[model samples]
Structure formats: structure tokens, C-alpha cells
Target: MPSKKDKGKAKATDAPPKEITQKDLEKLAKDVDKIASKVQHRQEKALAKGEPIKEKKIDPAKEAEMRKKIEAMVQALSNMEQTGAIKASGRKDMGDHKFWNTQPVLQHGEDVTEEGPIDPAVPRDQVQQEPYPLPKEFEWCEVDIQDDKQIIELYQLLTMNYVEDDDAQFRFDYSAPFLKWALQPPGWRKSWHVGVRVSSNKKLVAFISGIPAAVRSHKTLHHLTEINYLCVHKKLRSKRLAPVLIKEITRRSHLEGVFQAAYTGGIVLPTPIATCRYYHRSLNPKKLVECNFSRVPRNSTISAMVKKFKVAEQPSTPGLREMKPEDATQVRELLNKYLSKFDVAPVFETDDDVRHWLAPTPEVVWSYVVEDTKTHKITDFFSFYTLPSSVIGNDKHKSLNAAYMFYYAIDIPEKEAADSYDTARYTKQRLTELMRDALVLAKQADFDVFNALNLMDNSMFIDDLKFGPGDGYLNYYLYNWKCRDIKPHKVGLVML
Candidate 1:
């Protein structure tokens, strides 16, 4: 869902939108069309080469028809805060959310003075014992992810139809090992790996999944499921399969004793507890431009672009090294203590959970720590995970290897009790130092891009590290719970 996030979010149009003129909408359309066209052009060029690729762009009946769509999207979003009537890209507003309005999620424009679940919880015994009914031709299936054959089938389905860029130049290429690791975190339920299939042919076409997690919102701690990978075959999206997939996952999660859930999306729905912008630091600028992931700016040369993103060949942290099994205890204490400063975060109950999540998994995650050389005590830590994207039409580059910033912690004084102003500033400097090493490590690992969301203390180093804001925005939503809006820095949890 995060990768196929062309739906865009609030960075384009905020709630209670300001008055925008007809001229403003027209101008925005030109900018949007130009960005979309470049990526489309790159995809076609690759198709003519030897690599087999799907042709997504059709010759427009008239250029005006294409422009009309973009103009309509701009106008619709400009009026969204007041009217809640955006209908482009299969998205619906709060009032037009026929399916969502009936759910327990908070509605858009509802001034939230209290933070709690919108609906009362039902006993698990009272929950539905049967799966939601599907069309006669289709049926529900609980995928056994441990089985090799089934895993292959699920991988094939997603590889062909999962998250794709708007111009179709790139699609998420999640590996089988990654799926096994992400879906089988501590306390994961087999039933929560929900899927749909054609009954006769037994072909998997749609899927959604949830893993157990403990999330803290403001002052309250909750046992909730982290829902993700919600994908429906492209041809069947108009069939209203998305809502069904959501309902099925909720039902499965409820039976597993999870009453609340959290999810991230590229579009604004019902309401967002928090919204974060995606920032990308190019590790391989030349490959990114060739794959249409980024562009060489009008006034910039390739060498200039390359020079701007360069980092130290070696990390400067004195005692930094790869984290070991014994470091789990210190890391948990550090991460939990650090996360407590945020308004929303996860509450880790034990060090075993930390090892399960943060212990380095080769090819899946890379984590490192900074220890006090004199005392031999851990002082700070950082980590990132691998998630590569298929560069659809690039003849030379088959994949755009990306490293997504994950759980990281540093020593910082609480905002309320600061001994000196320089302490906070010093912490920012230390974070920049750690982050620069992360960039260098990502480059050493041969990643084409390093991405991070505007969450936690990321704002401190984002600009200083030369990361640029991306076209995408991820909206954080709490499934059954409701709360006041969460600002970026206040958001601590990062959903995969």
C-alpha cells in the first residue's frame, strides 16, 4: 500500500483548505501532468528494448482529456476539507465514504476533543464465527505462508499487480524472504494472512494481512494489529473487493483478540491520526534518473548532483559496530526510553521482542550501535531495512534497491527539562552524524535510494543531510480508536 501510493495525501491539500482560484487549479494541473509524462516516456522507451514490459499508457484521444482529469483532481482536493467530496482515483471523502462511514473509524472534519474508540468493543465470542460471504465464483482462503508453493503463488500475484508508480515505470518487488519475515513477527496468526481466490481455478487474486503489535497513543497503551499489504487484482478493483478485504482482515484480527488496528495509506480516508511526507536521499543519482525515479533539475549538471549527496567513506562514531545478541537489552532500554518522548509510539514489554525485531536479519535488516568506548555502554543506535522496486522499463537497471529508515534512537534531553539550549542542539548534531553514516552504509551496500518519513526526530537531520521531499505522503490511521491529530515529530512508530 505504501509503494502503490500514487493516491497522494494532505501535503497537496490540507484540511479546511484555503480559497484557491480557477487559475491555481489550472497551473497545478500543468505541473502534475509534466511529472507524470516523464515517467511514462521512460517506461515506453524500455518496452522497445529487449526487456519484456507491460504498456500502460494509451494514446490520448485528445490532450485535453488527460489535462481535464488532472484539473478535476486539483479542484476536488481544494474543496475536500469543506465538502469531503473528492472522488478521483477511486477515493472517497468522509461523507461519500459509504463503506467507511459505517465503520468505527473517525470521520473527517469531526473535531476530536477526546481520544478513544469510536465504537464499543464486542466480546470475541459475539464476533462472527464465519468468514464474510464472497461472490459465488470466489472464496476466502487463509494462506499458509510457510509453505513454499503457496508463498510462490502469493509472490507472483503481488509482483504482477502490487503497488506501482502512477506512470507505471516502477512497481514494488517484495521478496519471498521479506514476506516470511514481515508476516511472521511475534504472535502472528495464520488466519490473519487473508486472501481471496477464484473457487474453480483456485487462483489467488486479492490479499490483506495483519500482525500483532502494542501501540501507545498519547497516554494510553493498546494491543492492536498492524495491517498492511492490502492488494486487490487490478481488474477486480471496480468490483468493490477492497472493502471486502478490509472487513475480512478485521474479522480475522478480532478473533485473534486484537480489538484495535493501525494502518498507513497514500490517500486520506475517513481521517488520519497523523500524516508524514516521504523524503528520499539518492545513493545512486545516475541510476535513479535513468529509472525515472528522480530527474536532473533544469539548472543542475550530473556531476553537481552527485557531489551534493556525497558522504564520508567511513563512519566517525567512535565505538560504533554491528549490534550483537547481548546488545538486545541495552538497545531495548535505549529505544523505549527514546520513544517515550513522542506522543505516539510502541510499548515494548521485553528485550526478546527487541531481538525479534531489531536483531539483524541478513538481506532484510541492518542494525548498528554506538557504545561508549571508555565505559563499554551503548549510547546510541540506528537501523534500516531493504525494499527494492522494479524499475519497469529501464533496460540497464532491473531494480532500484532502496533502504527504508527503520527504528533508531539517540540520547536526548526531554523538551520540558533542558539543562542548556546547547544540549538539544548537540543532540541534533549527534543525530546528523549517525544519519550520515547510515547514508554511507546504504551506499556501500549498493542501494540506489535511502528513504525516510518525517517522523520522530527525522526533521533534525532531513534538510542537513540533503534529502529531498518526494511526491508521496503516507497517512497514519488508527482503525477503531480516535484521537486528536498527531504532528510529525510526535509520531514514533514506523509501519512497514
Candidate 2:
């Protein structure tokens, strides 16, 4: 993910040109004349001061050539604007994606029929042995996440300077325990937890990390390093450290023979294989409205809004229980079977990987399963993790407790399936029941809201569960790989 404070820059020029109006040409001419007059006046002042200003006289043909060149430059800039190089959102187009343009990602509007890496793999020995050079006074270091003090330092840095809502009303507050749980997953590498610190005071200013995963796209499965949590201090954004952090992490991953990476960001970069929207369900409508995280309807009263979103204290699922260590193996089999139906998904090779990601962790992750009472088989499961956001300047609430929906699965017997339509209906019915129970559990836990992306089969229950569409959109990117654009329903992998 790109840093919220320090996004990289780039350039592009393949767009077609738009016609330039005569009035526009006249305005460009006048602007050039004004610049020439300003320069002449500066030269005259230098001569009066005995600075011996050197002057060059332009012949008529040379002057015409200069004017023509200036017009061409103006036309190119105008073309850029017409092609959305300068967007209404104030984001630059693919041509201006300075950092991503140099990487192995696809450019905007590029089509793909065959999926493969944009760059071929290099031998491990050919990978960079030394870390990329940092700006003067800033040195690269591997963050020791196991140490409590170092983890606290990382926590503080992210809490104060990480991703925030556009209105600045809230900022992500990833807890210390959550950081450790996310960064130290299965196949984690200590060396991939890259950080930069100030040499003078030893203050950590920037960080980027990667964790190994096996991801399947279409018929091919690839081992990839999932990159995330990229952040830079607000004051150091001008130093262009975000790009450096990205390059350094990529180098480290390459040294381990991983050639492709996956990530998600709120902002658009060179290109995205899938774009997903966030949907939120209010658990505590009054708190959300008071904190400006949401608003009460203009026609509805606070009491009405609160009553509308209220959930039952108990879950509806009969055999639902918190997941235990023994449940990991069954959950992994169920999840992998369900995920295989998607176009892109993760490959959990062992029960350990499932336990690390889906098993319950107090105050960090909560997973539950529905077991068949007679057969004692795990038939369904769902999970959500805590990711609270600090409610900026809100006196009533200090933080908005949020539960983000994670991996989930439901068993559908192949022998009972008559056709695709019946299978779709069965899946929808099972997921809706499971998710409703999940929402009740979240409400009982005192979460202010429950959030989920419009990915996988979430579209089946989002509206039925009263989850309103969010303003944010997350774009999923694959580094060094090109794949056909996927719809939200076809995306099974979720990034932290």
C-alpha cells in the first residue's frame, strides 16, 4: 500500500490529443509575452547595477520556432488534463505515476489476455545483496517486532501518522497486539519487516513489510510476498522516502526468490486487478452519529435510527461456538474447498497456516464455527477482527470500535446440488444466516460498527443486512504480474 502522506510520482504520454481552441492559443501567447517582458526587465535592472548582463538577440525565424515549441508544450499539458492525468479527485493519471511506472505493474487502460509476470525471475545470487541507499541521515533497519519496546515504537508511529479518513474525522489505530498478530503470521521473515530511522536521534520515521503466501490466480498458483502497512512520517514526505521503502522491501523479497507481490490501497496507482468498495453496518447508531462517523437520516429520529440497527443479544445459529485449536484442521479444509470456487484465492497448505490466520486471539481476532450436532462435523465458520479508529476531536467518543469481516465458509453438499442456480441459492441462504449471527456477536461485543468489502460472496448479504455503502474504495494490485480484471464477487483474498 502507498503511504497516505507520501505517494510516489510518475509520467505517461500515450493518450490522444484534444483540439486546442483559438482562444486558448491566444491566452498561451499572452502568457509567454508576459514572461519575456519580465525577463527583459530583470536584465535591465542587472545592467544598471553594473552586473554586466549578457544578452542574445533572437532572429525572426528563431523567435517563431520558440513560439511553436511553447505551443506544443501547452498542447501536451492540455491533452493530459483531457485524459484525466489531472483528475477531479486531484490524483495524477498513469503517465504521472513516477514510481509505479518504473516498476513491473501494468499501466492504466492496458488490456491483458494471458496472465503472467511482467518481469522474469532472476537467480537468487543476482538479487541486490546490499540495501538501497537512503537519504542522508536516515538509515535502514530491520524492526525487531518481538521486542515490546520496539513494537511500541512502531505502534506509536502508525497511530499518529498512518491512514486516515479524507475528512480527518478518524484515523486507523492498529493495536500493538494486532500488529504482532498480523506481522508474525506463518512463513514470516524478520528481515522483511523493514524500517527507517533518523541517524541523529534514532527516531523511526518510515516502515514497509512483507509476509509470504501462496496465492492462486485462475489455473496457476504462485508463491507471493504480500506487502502492506507502508507509512512515512508527515514531515518527511518531501524527502521521497515511501518509494525507497517500497524498493528496499522488494529487494529483500527478491533475495528470497519471490518475484511477485500483492497489496491493496485506497488510492489508485499504476493499475489495479480488482477494485472493491467497503460497506458498513451500524451496531451503535447513536455513537456513530454523535461521532460524525455516520449521520441520522434527515427524516428519522435518533431513537428510530437506534431501533432500526439493534441486534439480538444471542446468535441464531444453534451449534455456533468459539473456534478451538482442534478445529483448525476442519476449518482449513472447509475454507479451502469454499475458496477454490473463486477466480483468485489463497492456498492454505497446512492447518498451522489456518490457525495463525483464522484461530481466535483475544482483543485481536474472533472466529467461530458451526458444528453438526449428530455428525460432529464442522459445517460452517465465520470470523471478524478488531480494528478501532480514533475519533478525531470527538468529545463523546474517543474511539470507534470496529469489527472487520474476515474469512468465512459454508458447506454445500455436491450430491444435493441440482444445478448452478440451486447451488447459488443454497450458498446465499447459508451465508446470510451465518453473517447475521456474526453481526449479532459483534453487537454483543460492543463494537460500534461492522465492516466488510463487496468481495467474495459478500454482495449476497450486504443489502439484506442493512450495510450502507461506504465512501472508500480499495484497489488491489499485483506487482510484476498481469491478470485480467476481476469482479468483486470473484476476489477471495483479503489484505490486512
Candidate 3:
């Protein structure tokens, strides 16, 4: 999925693209350098005056006009470098979604009163037999993730070209171990790890991947394909390879007897079944401020900011400990029951699913469970994953460690009546306590910040825990599936 404000640009044009020459790219780079210098100077001036870190009042008309111009400039440059094909434009209408409009996705502003697949499933025999034709210079290949050399190749491609923040101040640094953990979940397939390479040199240049999962949209259960890690080399943007990669992946998924797919983007496409906002809880305030990941208040000092975000040294929740393999069964039962309350959620049908996803993996993921001190039964569980970002142009700090909230389940008391207010209130209070413990643990692990989306019951703790809203929005899309809008609280799905 795309991050805030880095959603690249408009959909690529199909017409033969006028090749962007090296000189053209250099000129664009120079223009961006000038803008960046000016912005940096402004930031230094603000810091000198102890400026407030809040939006300034501005005329609506002027703000809108100014925003449009900035977006255009950023989009044009980022399109060649961004990791996702999403855009952060103000225009609600689809702009040259020539390919998406033709696909089975819901049209922009289209109403959905019913839920089901937008396109009929095709038989395996009828699916495309050969891969989609890549440009003559490039050829398709199945990346052997198990192969160290191949995985490293994929890692290098992403490390250089993956997502960067709106200001280019930070870029996600997905470790090789982390990539393996994410792409090789239970029932993963080599065929789904699609990649493209230069035909002559066999150099991996572009990639897109899919993984099988049992996702339920309301009452309809679909064994859908979760699409992710769509990346194209920066130089190949004008080659119109993104659509081709998507089509190829779709074809391969169809051949595997899967039709429907789920993906997310930062931009508004034809339609989105749900839109979630991001929230950030700073752990290392001093580091965040120095990296430009955050800013201090007008009258605040770095030490004050740190004190404001500090957490207790120990967890308040009794019996909470690191999750173990044996806890998978109990955790699975509790998680499934909790997820059932959501309109859209994953179905962890087996204990292996629980262990594979929720069990802790050092430095990559962390999971903990609360137990009944005497009963020896699981009471609650929470999990988060590590995803550090490279701090661009920061001399003191080279990276910012970030922990992302993954999934959790708690023992909600039985409702006395339908829609019981007391039950909801209790749920909020308990979640707040557990999540605060999570923050403490993450801080102990030396993370600089914790990030989460406003899905599930997260809203209950966000404000109480001092999490500020972020500029990014993640739009959840179900390809070939039509479902009514799902409220953020009713969404239980989380994508890596």
C-alpha cells in the first residue's frame, strides 16, 4: 500500500510515452533540489523562532489552488520513483483510469446495494495460458524467494525504489528477513512471487506478488488473493509496465483457481469499500524531531516532549507475557470469535494460521498474550511488527524504528442486551490498558514511534493514548468483489 502524500501520480497513459531522457530527469531533479532547499530553510527559520507545529489559517481558495500546484509538481517527480500507483489529488473524479475503469472494480461514485463478485469466475482451462507480454527488453520470471541470491535481488530492487514519505524525509527499509516473513506466510506459492528481469542481463527490474487467503466480506466467504509488493524500477515508469504486471498477476491467480483479489492504495480509485486514517504515537520524541518525522510545539522543549510521551517501565496488565507456540489454539479461538463481529475480516481456519501469523518472530514481529493467573486460559492478545524507515539526509539519525499495530483479540464480556453500551465501554477501557502496555514494550524494544490505522476498536485508545492523526489515508479495495461501504470500526483486515 502507498503511504501518505507519496501516492505517485495519475494513471499512466497508454499511448506510446515520449521517452523521458536523462537530461529531462536531471532537470526535474534540479527543480526538486531548489524546492527542497527552500523548504529546509523555512524549517530552520521556524525552529529558530520556536514556531508551532500546527496548520496555519489560510484562505480556502488560495490554499486549494496552492495545493493543486504542489501536488502536480510532486506527483510528476514521484511518479518515476514512488512504490505504489496511488495519487493524493483532490479531484474526486477518476483521472484517466483507462485500465481500472475497464476492470471489474467498482466505478467512482458508483453505489453498491448488494455484495458479490463483479466478474464471473473463469475456469482454469479458460484462463490465459501464457504470461502477459512484457516489453521486448524485459521478460517475466518466478522469483524463488527461498533462493538467497534471488531474494537479495528482490530486496535490492525494493530498498532502492520502495515507498518514501511525502517530504522524502523517510523511506521504508524492509529487511531481507522481514520480506521473507511477509511473503512466505502459510500456503504461499512460488508462482505467485512474480518478477520481471532484463532479457539480456537477467537483472530483476520489476515485481508484483500475490498470496492466498480466506477473506470474508460480510457473510460471503471468498478464498481471495491478497496482492501486494507491486514495484517497478524507477526508469521503467514510462514503459507502461505497471498495468502489465497487474494483469499478469491476475492471470496467474486465475490459473490457481482464485479470482477475487484484495489490495490497498493511498489514492482514491474508482471506489473503495473502506477508507482508514493513520495515527502516530511518538516513542522517541527527540529522535523524531531531529529527523523531521515530527515537530515540537511553539513553547515546548525536547525534554518536555519526551516527558509527555513517556510510558511506564512495566506493563500494568497482569499475566501478560510473550506469546508461545502452544497458545496458538486458544489464541485462534479467541481471535476468530472477535473477528466475527467485523463486516470484513480474515478467517484463520486452523491453528497453523494463528501460529504463522500471530506467533512472535524476533526483530520482525512481536506477540503477547494475557492469561488468567489461575485458570491458565488466554484472556487477551496483541501483536505488532517492526518496520524501520531510513531517515533521509539526517546526520545524527540514520533510521527511525517504527512499530505497527497488527491484530489483537480480547475477552469481551457477554452483552446483557443487543448493542449493549456497557459492553462497548468495557471493551474500550480494556483495550486502552492493553495498548498502553504495547507502547511500553515497543519503547523498551527501542522503537522511535508506533503507527496504527483507525480500524477495529482502535479509535477507543487513539486519543486517550496521545496519538495524533496522520496525513495519509489507506483505501481498501476488493477487486472483482462488490460490497457495501464498511465502517472503519467494522474493518478487521490488516495488510503488510
Candidate 4:
């Protein structure tokens, strides 16, 4: 704008900035394409050689952050599964969470496992061995009333594992109650109570008890011993002790002039006599369900019936008469034939077992035999007994009461002639008729209740009898044995 040098300085200061053109933009694009192609070629070559692609290095701090996030996600999933908010897939589902989370994996069949910390209370080995040692000076003795302590101990030992079955009433713990009852004033005779003792220590570890039978209704006699409270210690079970006890009891029974002995167990060990069915009358439906006595049914009426029928009474029948002692031998023959139909029979075959079961007492057992007077032979026989009543909240009602329909037998004159006169069918018909007879006798005796156990096959007959169901049933287990086909029997009445 002025002189040549000044003008050039001014012009330089005022010069305009150059703008980017399409050509320059196209050149930059080409350079970017070249770089991308080189990167692609490198990646292809690396991939062909099975090498990971080259990546730009990331910050160690960022990598740690990313790792923590992934770990947290995994933990959340596990937590959800544990809380049942989510389910685990595959093999994890098969394992119990308590074992998986708390216990270490255990080796199969090993006595010990790494499942968490071992419980010090539990034994390392649980298998029991056989051939238990018996006391050197052990003597089998008849129970004398004076030997109250020994008798009490024997009862305690037998009832140690007394679990009331789903079908029993008036729960009995064999030991304590037996001791208390046996030692009451005018205590049970020592002869009726048989026990095995270590001669040195006089520790009464095993025993078998019996009570004499008496007359009941219908001119029938009961000459039998009711065997009960048989028990042995766990350590002494392998000593083959029960049969010895049985033989000793049988001897005592014969000494007492008894011919038959009756008892019950879950399994028919020692004897495989007649089998009985089971029926349960529930007291509390909810409680029964909780205790597994009865399952909750879909029909409320069935459930209500089981719950309410526990104390209901059946109508009494007539034509019953008191039993007589003179009828002993005839009753014996009838019972023998009755028992002979079954593969299992009671342990008492000798006069000993029979004598003990037949003696009269305040709590007398009675028998009634309906006879064909013209034929001068017995047609049917039923046995029952009286006990101090066990009805709750009624002190006045707790008097001598007749309970337990123990056993019954009917004569089948055409057994050999009639093809259909087998044990099962005959038993069913006889039992049905026996119910009618029982009702008649109950009414004549002015009894408020008559109870009978629906033993194994007898369940088929129970539904027909209109007998009220009971809340409890007896359970039996073998002391140290197994059986192939021991048929079960109904609960027969016996006097203690």
C-alpha cells in the first residue's frame, strides 16, 4: 500500500487463509483406504496362522474394572439360583444346595466324607456286629411277686423302643408302666413273670410276662396265657435270647396248667398264625396328617369319618351268656383246630402256656362258644376281656369295662367235603357272624364299647361289622430275624 518493503510487509500481514478443496479431501481418503487395507491384510495373515489379531493395549486399570464387573455378574446369577429366584441349568440342578454350598464332595461308599465339618456326636462307624456276649452266670428264673425290681427292669427293657403304632390306643411304654402296674398292691405273681438274669449281677435284661385267662360270656372258657413285654437289650439281641425266654415262659405256663398263650407283633416271628387287617380312626385330621397316620383325602367326608368315628359305638346284640371253667378242654380243641388252619401258631403248645392264660382274676378274660346243642359240639367261639375303662374326662366311666375282641373261631363241618371251605373264605364268614354275636353280647353285658383290631386280612371283614374305628394300632418287628411268608393276624383280645 505504500513503499515496496512496507507494502510487502502489510500485504503479508493481510494475506487470506487457504480453504481445503475437493482434491485435498480425495487425497486424504486414499491415504485412509491404504491404511485400512494394510490392517485387513495383517489380520487375514494372522488369522490364517491361527494367531490372535493384534490389538491396541488397554489400560490395566480399565481391564481390572471390566473383570470385576464380570465377576459380579456371575455372583449375582449364583445368588439368584440359591434363593430360588432362578434355576441352575444342567448338572448343577441335580445337587442339593445345602450339600453343594456347605459340604464338601463325599466319596461314594466311604465311611467318612469331607462334607463340611464332621459332627462329633455321630459315630464314625454305625454297623453293628453279631454274637453278643452273654453273662457267664446267667440264670433263667420264674418271676416271683417278691422280685418286683427284676420284673420292673424287664418291663422297662422291653418297652425301651415302644413306638405307638398308627393303630394303638392307651399308649404303653412296656417298662415303666409294667413296673408300676406289676408292683401295685397285691402285686403280680413272680411265677407269671419269667425273666433271665446274670447270676452274678442279677441284672434282669430279658423277660416274657403272662397273665391267666378266665371265663367270659356264653359258657365258653379261656384257658390261655396272654404273653407280653418280651424285650432284650440291643447288645444282647444276637445271643439268640428270645426262644430261650419263650421256652422258660412256656414252662411257667404249663406249671400253671394253661394250654394256650396269645400275643401280637408287627411281624409274625416265632409263629406265623392268622393274619389281621389294619384300620385307623384319626383323632385330629391335621395331627394325623402331620404324624403320617393318615393321608389327607380329596373327599372331606372320608376325612371327617376317619376323624369322628374314633369314639362311636355300635348297637349291642342279645343271646350272650357268661363263660364257665368246665368248658376248658372243649375250648382248647376248638382253638387248636382254629389255629391249625394257619402256618403259624402261638408259642404255647404245652400245658404250661395254656395254664397261665386260663386262670381267673379281677380283670378276667371271658369266652363265649355258641353250640349246636343237638350235635353237642361247639359251632362258634369268641373271646373278650374286661379292663378298667380308659375313656377321657369321665371319672365315673373308668370302671370295669369290656374291650378287645381278641379271637374267634367257627366250626366248618364240611371242611373236607366242601371244595370252597378254605381258611380264607371260612374266616371271612365266621368273622362276619362273630360281629353279630359280639353286638348281642355287648348289649347283654350293658357295655358302652367293644373294640377289636382289624388285623391284616381281617380288614376286609371290618368294613362289614359296623365297628367304630380306633385311633391306634399295634406294630410288631422281629427281634433278630426274617421271614418269607408270615401272614399277619388281627389284634386279639388278651388280659394283662
Off by over 4 Å in 4: 1-143, 146-227, 230-320, 347-362, 387-402, 415-417, 421-427, 443-449, 468-473, 477-482, 489-496
TM-scores of all models? 0.83, 0.83, 0.83, 0.42
Candidate 4: tens digits of C-alpha lDDT, residues 153-198: 6555544423222222222333343343433322144666766777
Error of 1 at 56 (Å): 53
Could you tell me the lDDT of residue 230 within candidate 2? 94
Once superposed on the true structure, which residue ranges of model 3 sit more than 4 Å away at CA?
1-95, 415-419
Candidate 2 regions off by >4 Å? Answer: 1-92
lDDT of 2 by residue, 436-470 (tens): 99999999898989999878899668767888756
Q: Which has the higher lDDT value, candidate number 1 or candidate number 4? A: 1
Among all windows of ten consecutive residues in candidate 1, which has the lowest summed lDDT? 8-17
Off by over 4 Å in 1: 1-94, 413-417
lDDT of each: 0.78, 0.80, 0.79, 0.43
The TM-score between candidate 2 and the true structure equals 0.83
Clashes of 3: 1
Ranking by lDDT: 2, 3, 1, 4
> Better model by lDDT, 2 or 3?
2
lDDT string, candidate 1, 1-496, tens digits = 1353643233333333346543466577557555555644465457447455466544433443454455345534533532334344434434777788889988878888888887777888989998899989999998899999999888888887888765577778888888888889888889999999999999999999999888899999999999989888888877888998999899888787777999987666777887776788998888888877778999998788898877778887889899887899999999998899888898777787788788888888899999998988898989999988877767888888999999999866466237643454566678989999999888989888999987888866877788876655677899889888777678999888
